[model samples]
Target: MVRKPDFKILYVDDEPKSLRYFKKTFSSDFIIVTADSGAEALDILSDAGNNIGILIADQRMPEMTGVEVIQKARSFAPEIVSLLITAYMDLDVALDAINGGHIFQFICKPWSTDSLKIMLLEAAQEYERNRHCLILEQKNRELEESRRTQERFIYTLSHEVRTPVGLSLNYSDALLESTLSEEQREYATSINVVNQSLLSVLDNTLDYSMWESGKLVLHEFPFKLSDLLERIEQAFGLQFKTANVNFVLKRSTEGIDNLVGDPDCLFQVLVNLLSNAIKYSAAGKEIELSIEILKSSDRSVDLRFAVTDTGEGIAKAIMDRLFKPFSQLQTAREGSGLGLLISKELVTMMGGEIGVNSEQGKGSEFWFEVEFWLGSDSSDGEEPLNGSRTVEGIPILLAEDSAVGQAMVDGLLSPGIQRGDR
Candidate 1:
């Protein structure tokens, strides 16, 4: 298993014994980096550029107090979890640090080893939670941008569909007049064929929404992935023949035949990828599909699949928005721009992730990884999907600096709790 990124903690104090003691207590779980004073701690952080998951600093030092150090650390690394360890009861300074530096906890000095360890672990977990929230916020921003792009796409799709419909209507009207020449009648028939093709594209645009809303249910059963691939090939064979696009499909393992999944939804993802590959692919170029299994953790597996095309590759500037809904590579032409978005949503619904890699003029590869369950009871089976698990029951440690809020939380958590007068 790839080790979860180390949770780094920085402890700053004047006493070497205290630092050593704290290190000995939590060294196994946390990467504990220590300094004799606040200035030394700042030097260490600046030099190493430590991605400090948590910071624990002593209240009084020769140069600066724990609160001052945390306040300064906030400017350099605003996201690091901070804790203030103080021997003195300076309520005003502690409150200022909590508000200004966004400190996670305030630990009183002469602390118990057990309590301190538990507190640090809780802070680390909260740090990870915040990190995930930040990632989701970024994705949401990209989604917004994609929505704006789709607005333009809707206009473009409307224009593309309307032009053919208008032409077909005029040609049919002319044909019905009963005064058209033979050449004009032949032209009208051609217009009808073109209109049908345009309608097919429009149908694809509508199909995108179906897959997105989970309205398009998949047939779930045991089936060889290869059979599905063949079905895809048969379905898209005519498009390849018409476009003159070369196709290549490869599988890494032979024994990996059958999979327990919704093959129909999987087919839709493949079709969307393959369609994009062919549509954007340079005429007479090759498109390829490959599949393999990757171990994401000690007891989990992910099926990685990729579709590569030799076509106008995506630009780097827009790579960040590739998975975003309704994003087109470039708007030089017209499109609904929702193919990749719906494809991502479909894969995600099946406990998977989707991403893309592209280079200008060098073509692009769209890939997704789905949690894989082996046919046999392998040690590493499938795991729950991202964001699927909820915290059913866990202790919450709120380290609010406000006395009133702290009292309220304690009262709610335990009705009989009482605190001594200040």
Candidate 2:
């Protein structure tokens, strides 16, 4: 069933015959009000308090012209759109209606049913647009206020907390190096590490806030996935080893090894996923990393990526908000809860996506998929995919604006050309 429109319109004319005809024509579309004179129309509007959406007036009335009638109508309902009816001979009156009464539009007398219907619909659309724009401007002003509040909070947090924590970490480091017993030295080292961890959490918190505020910056460049994966493994190797977690790597597409992208963002994504997996998994469980080619239905192009994990499976409900920032679910007890959120944001900024799948008792698998350019260098390099043939010597372009990105891109595309600032 169609929903009935909720607007009420008031149509005024000094001719009773014309008024009756309008009542018959527009009774279904609007609440039609008729009057034999402008004075009677004003009396009706004044009595009803003008909650009207549209005011339609006939031009050649005696006591008052259509422009005069609508001009008075504005005082009753400032929000209502006024329209005037005029014949060709009353062109001057139509202009007068627009200038003196702020008429939204005018219709020629003897308007066709179709034309009238179109005019009313256009007026309704205009009303909705103006209403929404006003609402948007109001919302924007509130958002600006909220941003100011957040900036003040960050200022206080940085000054009031970070400085003292920094000094404590420095003193703890000094104490670790001094002439002390082995146990004391170990305790000092532990204190230093804990302090550093706390500091890192605080920093990540600030970064997360910046990201939430849409202020995070990304520097994209060419980087080797193999090299990036190696660096990540090296950093997390000790943690996995201590936990007795087995780490496995399987490559399927070597074409992406020397691909163009942001290495730091990619590394951060992998690190966050791997770190979380290690944190939540049972000791001695296996953490697998594997890449494969993904072909779209069209079969003309493909993408590549890896999934790594060794953790108790994520619950269905927990998995739903896994990527939401500051959303720490039962399945996520790894870092400050900002790691995956930041990682996901970084991956998206670099034109990639991260996803996860898991059963309740089985371990979860976190994966990242990125668009890879097929290269043609099968003879020289070992393929990331064991069985698939590698494309050779694909000409890849690297672009960057920052020094760090330039260096990263230069390193990734060793034998390829590098470009800056398109």
Candidate 3:
């Protein structure tokens, strides 16, 4: 069924007889409003412009021409579809007006009722299309503004958080080096671990923001696959051991050892997977890491790495959105909910595919397959600390704009301050 159009059709002419005839012809099909002159039509439009969709005006009026009235009416209601009616045989003026987009259609002095009705129908459809397009443009602008606002908020929050977290970590390290009892040392270590976790959350949140804004870039370098796996094992070994979860790593084939890729990104993906496994698995359960040689050639090698956890498996319904940003399946645990999302994006950026297999009762297996070219020169795979260094007994200058950040830094470094060092 066709819905009735709510907008009215406006007809303007210098002759009262033509106005009457137009209203009498189209009154049943549309809400017809008649004006006898261009000036009067402008007045009607100025009063009720939004309700008028189509404007049909006669040319050669005493006060103004149809094109003049249409050009002016467009300023008030830009979505109105305009039509020109003229009896004079001069085509130059009509052509100019049509080219200027002041008119949608031109009708001769003696226009057939059926053809005029069809033209009005087309004009109504055009008006609707223009309205819809305008709405979409407005919505897109709003969405872009919202995204920018969110990015700004995330950046500000991350900066505000990092200052204190960094100071805490530095102070905790100093405390660990100082003399203390076994219980005191344990307490300080716990504090340092918790602060490191907080710092990790902040870093992950910033990385997620970068990915959302399309600013994350991958840096490639030559590295040993075995070295990368060894680093992953070293990083998570203590955590898994403390949790009593068995951590296993199956080495890659001998031929596919050295490869060219982003070792930092590869290690991050593995760490995220292992961390999740450790977090979800129960004590005494097993968490296994294995690498399989999917395909190997002279230049490139494809390796599939899987992290299997003998923990409570995920439901089928939640599996689809498992990798979405801020989507956490186990809400009981504390997390930033961006680890899986960042891992997925990092894997894809490195020309890889990641997936998960799980059942309600059975455990979950998360795996990724990535291909890397075998590097020509052998690399020791010893990663340099990316611009990180420590210096002792050197007077350091700290510049922090926020007063709270300045106080936190001062408190953290007070123990190292000598007499008259203020």
Q: How many clashes in each structure?
A: 0, 13, 0
Better of 1 and 3 by lDDT: 3
As a TM-score, model 3 comes out at 0.66
Candidate 1 on 62-130: residue-level lDDT in tens?
879888888787777666788888765765666677777468878887898889888887888877887
Greater-TM-score candidate between 1 and 3: 3
Cα RMSD of all models vs. native, in order, equals: 25.0, 13.4, 6.6
Per-model CA lDDT versus the true structure:
0.72, 0.70, 0.83
lDDT of 1: 0.72
Model 2 CA deviation exceeding 4 Å by range: 1-140, 148-218, 241-246, 249-257, 291-307, 325-335, 372-422
The candidate scoring highest on TM-score is 3
| TM-score computed on alpha carbons, candidate 2 | 0.48
TM-score of each: 0.41, 0.48, 0.66
Model 3, range 282-396, lDDT digits (tens) per residue?
9999999999889988899898999999988888888898998667675655566788999999999999999999986778999999998888755347555442333455698
For candidate 2, which ten residues in a row score worst on lDDT? 413-422
TM-score-superior candidate, 1 or 2: 2
Alpha-carbon shift of residue 342 in model 2 (angstroms): 3.2
